[model samples]
Target chain A: SQKIEQNSEALNIQEGKTATLTCNYTNYSPAYLQWYRQDPGRGPVFLLLIRENEKEKRKERLKVTFDTTLKQSLFHITASQPADSATYLCALETNNAGNMLTFGGGTRLMVKP
Target chain B: DVKVTQSSRYLVKRTGEKVFLECVQDMDHENMFWYRQDPGLGLRLIYFSYDVKMKEKGDIPEGYSVSREKKERFSLILESASTNQTSMYLCASGILYEQYFGPGTRLTVT
Candidate 1:
């Protein structure tokens, strides 16, 4: 069976600082890794996706890095704001039919102003 | 933008009662998924349909069943709900890579 792990502890950081969250997986090789932002009582919204061949991807204020060798992915929010406080989840494409995904126990980030 | 809508935002049911969760998508996507989110377990896939009448069991499908009679609608069924079945249920629709999720349905089974 495959396993995904994220920091179960909540990460607290000051606003405008950078928040880094980690996701590690074992026993499975994924083709694509993705990050999602989930607010309390809301469904997760897509953040970014990186292929196994890619090293890093960046959006406006979000960056995601994939390290296949380490079976890990790092999600970063630079210049974080209080509104960025939410649970961040990492998912790996199961590479099977229908493009199913396996998600890690997300790390909740609390950005303080 | 793709829109996914679930029938309920919150639900309460008793043990051994039959429960149904409905999801509809306007994107006409071919893939629809049902997942349950728990406190520490993250999001676990219960079932997914690739096309009409084609369903696949996901990681956790033991206590759940799904119906996809039409291309745009998918339903998750709990034949006999249990207390342990209480969780946040989410529906998603996607073509291949990116998925659009609906406002989750918080289900509480007592």
Candidate 2:
């Protein structure tokens, strides 16, 4: 079975600093990877998607990088604010999986002011 | 904006009781999914439907079943709910790749 791992510890950073979160996977080659943000007691909201062929994708102050060779994806939030505090999850889909996505445990990010 | 709505925000059920969690979407998406979220386990897919009257078992489907009679509505049924089934349940609708999720239902079975 494919396994996805993220930083189990919560990340605390000063507001306006860059927050980086890591997601590592094993035993699977995904065609595309996705990022989502989830606040307390709320469902996850879609953030960004990066394909295997694409190395980097950015939206607003958010950026995601996928490295198939390393089997890892990095999610970055630049110029972060206190509002950016949430649990960030990474999901991926392998070949022929269609819309089925395997998700990581997620890393909690707290941007302190 | 796409909207997915679940029947409840919180629910409490007893062991050996049958439970139903309903989800509705307004985006007319063809795919609907049911998932349970745990503290360290992330979101585990229980079942998914591609079209009307179609369903597929997901990673954790042993104690759950799903119904997709209409395109916009999907229901997750817990047959003889157990204490271990206590968790947050989420419903999602997707078109191609990106999925829109509902505000989850927190279910507690005692």
Candidate 3:
């Protein structure tokens, strides 16, 4: 069976530290992967997207690494702040269409001050 | 900025009642999707539409039906709302990879 997995447990880190989250999948070859941030009672907001050809992508404080061989993606937040605490989700394109995505369960990160 | 809007932030319905959830996007995106988010199940796709009047069943579309009569509007219909259907419903629209999402509607079926 095809499955996307994320750590359901909440990750706690001190402010100004680096936080890393993992997403693993089975039985799927995705063309690209996306990461989103979602707060309580709100919909997810797009953060970054990495294609299979790319190994790493970065935005101001966020970085994402994709490993197709291991079917895993890592999301890292540097100099994390309390305001950065939220549930982060990893999604994979299900087909060549690029519109359909399968999302992981999401991992919550808590950056304490 | 791309914006997607949902009709309600919260809703309550009785069992066996017919329910309709509406979503509209200001961006002229060709692809629109409806998904239900649960506690442990994550986000499950209910339905999606690539163009006006064209719809496709998603991973979990058993009791839910969808309509896309207009390019900017997509609707999800529950023929008979069930208790198990209580969940957060999300709507999104995008041209290809990056999707903009609505605020989401929390529906509670008693």
Highest TM-score: give the candidate number. 3
State the fnat of candidate 3 relative to the true structure: 0.84
**In terms of DockQ, which candidate is strongest?**
3
Candidate 3 Cα lDDT to native:
0.96
| Superior by DockQ: candidate 1 or candidate 3 | 3
Which segments of candidate 3 are over 4 A away from where they belong? none
Cα displacement (Å) at residue B99, model 1: 1.4
Best-to-worst ranking by lDDT? 3, 2, 1
Better of 1 and 2 by DockQ: 2
What is the TM-score of candidate 3?
Answer: 0.99
Candidate 1 per-residue lDDT, tens place, B1-110, comes to: 88999999999999999999999999899999999999878999999999999999998999899999999999999999999999999999998888889999999999
The digit string of per-residue lDDT tens for model 2 on B1-104 reads 99999999999999999999999999999999999999888899999999999999999999999999999999999989999999999999998899999999
**TM-score per candidate:** 0.98, 0.98, 0.99
lDDT: the better of candidates 2 and 3: 3
* Every model's DockQ: 0.80, 0.85, 0.90
Ranking by DockQ: 3, 2, 1
Kindly report which residue pairs in candidate 3 clash with one another: none
Query: Tens digit of lDDT per residue, candidate 1, span A1-113?
Result: 78999999999999999999999999978889989989999999989999989999999999999999999999999999999999999998886652788889899999999
Off by over 4 Å in 1: none
Q: What is the TM-score of chain B alone in each candidate?
A: 0.99, 0.99, 0.98
